[model samples]
Target: MTLEAIFGMASLLAIFSWIALFIFYPSKWIYQTLFSGVLIVLGIMYLFYLFTGIGSLADFNFDSLEQVRTVFSSDEALLAGWIHYLAFDLFVGMWISKDSWEKNISRWVLLPCLLFTFMMGPIGLMLYFIVRAIKTKKLNQSPFH
Candidate 1:
C-alpha cells in the first residue's frame, strides 16, 4: 500500500478507536490492546519510512517552526510526523479513558477530552487533567462534616 493509504488507515483507526471506547465500550482491555497495536504499527511504519529515506533521527532539529517545516516537506517526513501524533495522542486518549474509569469520572466528561485529543492531542491531555483534578478534589471534600 501507498504511504497515503497507510496514513489514512492509521488515522481512521486512531480516531475510531478512541470514540468507540468513549461511546460504545468502556474498560475493555481488548480495545486498549487494539489501540496500542495501531499505535505500534504507525510508529513502526514511520520508523521504516524514516530509515528508507533521509530522516535522521540522531540529528533531527526542532529549534524553530521553519526548521520543522523544512524537515516535514518530504512525504515520508510528513507521514512520520503525523504517525508520531497518532501514536502519542491515541495513547493519551486511551490512558484518559482508563484512568477516568478507575477514578469513577463520568463518560460525559471524558468524551470532550477524547474528542479534543483526537483533534489536538496535548490540549486534550491538559483538559482531562483539569477535569480529573476537579473531580478528585470534589471527591475529597467533606459533604457535611
Candidate 2:
C-alpha cells in the first residue's frame, strides 16, 4: 500500500477511537489523552503530507460538484481524509461549545472560538488556552485559586 493509504487508514482509526472513547467514558482523563494525542498525531501527519507533497491535503483544484464527486469516487485516500477532517472539526466545535458553557464564559467570546475552531482547528484551541490563562491570572489576583 501507498504511504497515503496508510496515513488515511490511520486517520480513520484515530477518529473512530475518539468516538469510542467519548461514548464509553465521557469526561475522563483517558478520553482527553486519547483524543488529544490522536488529533495531534493526525494533524502532524497531515502537515507532513502537505509540506512534502506526498498527497494533496486540501481540495484546491476541484471547482464544481461533479469534479468533487469524481475525485472522491476515484480516490479512497481522499475520502478517508475528508472523514478525518469532518470528524475532528465537528468535535472541536462541540468541545468549545461544551467547555464554554460549563465555564459560564461569555457567549460572545465563545462564538469566535467556535468559528475559529471550525476554520483552524488547533489554532483555535491554542487561542482558547491563552484566553483561559489570562482569565485565570486575573481571577487569581482577586484571591481565588
Which one is best on lDDT?
Answer: 1
Question: Candidates' TM-scores?
Answer: 0.80, 0.43
Per-residue lDDT over 1-145 for candidate 2, one digit per residue giving the tens place of the 0 to 100 score: 7866765677566556545543433255644665577666666665544444423546434689876564455344454455457557756655655565556666667656655665678887777666655655543222123
User: lDDT for each of the candidates?
Assistant: 0.75, 0.57
lDDT of 2: 0.57
How far off is residue 105 in model 1, in Å? Answer: 0.4
lDDT score for residue 41 of model 1? 80
Q: What is the C-alpha local distance difference test score of candidate 1? A: 0.75
lDDT of 1 by residue, 81-139 (tens): 78788878877777787788777898888888988988998899888878877988753
lDDT of 2 at 139: 30
